[model samples]
Target: MSSENDWNEDLFDCTNDCGTCFYGFCCAPCLFGSNAEKISEKNCCLMCCLYLVLSGVYLCWVPHYFERQKLREKYKLKSNPSCGDCPTTLLCSPCALCQEAREISSRENVRRIDFNGDNNQPVVSQPEATSDEVNHVDMRV
Candidate 1:
């Protein structure tokens, strides 16, 4: 985690990744939906559609801001909902989206799955106990 001053990508540096910037600029909703999927770890298509619906009323930034806050918290960036997150996501939504896309795409990212464990134990099943091995009680009087 970097310091508050050290963001993964500068908000103004949209040219950092031309592909993502272009995609985000062309289709902000698609970019935001993809970013939501990665951040929330849920259905991408559904999120895309949801963003599309939200975009119609310009309410998409609400979720986008929350997701940005999550990323900031997860990555240990500055937590400035009023000063940073709000201004960034609202004032410069496209750049903000591009910044998020760049951050997610950055190699510093850790993959969701890691095979770090040494799976050396072999699979084996326990034998079932025989009925004779069970304790018997005589209660007949």
Candidate 2:
């Protein structure tokens, strides 16, 4: 899991994957919708429609902020305290969408390739052994 204070991928590192950048540039609505759906675990088409309709707001990034925050937490990345999203999402929505898409795509691909591949088991930590579970011995000779 990534826990950096910055994004797992650079905001303008679209050149890392040109396909995602092109997709975001060609159809921002779909990119945002899919990202919302992934973060919210809801219907992609429905989220897409809602995002498209609500995008006219000057502060449309409000909704996306929540979703992007969720993605950051899900990937264990540190939250942005600089309030940079106001520009990353509001002024450059396409680039933001591209970054989000790349993050999800990279995380999903890594998950798929982990532990013999296709094995998506959660790695839970076991509790420490307790005194009750320990064996006791007598020192009698």
lDDT of each: 0.77, 0.76
Off by over 4 Å in 1: 1-5, 80-83, 107-141
Best by lDDT: 1
lDDT score, candidate 1, position 50: 78
Q: After superposition, how far is residue 68 of candidate 1 from its true place, in Å?
A: 0.5
TM-score of 1: 0.68
State how far residue 126 of model 2 sits from its true place (Å).
Answer: 33
Clashing residue pairs in candidate 1 are none
Per-residue lDDT over 14-131 for candidate 1, one digit per residue giving the tens place of the 0 to 100 score: 8778999999999988898898888778577887787789889988788788989877766777654555788777778888999988887772444433443578444446797666
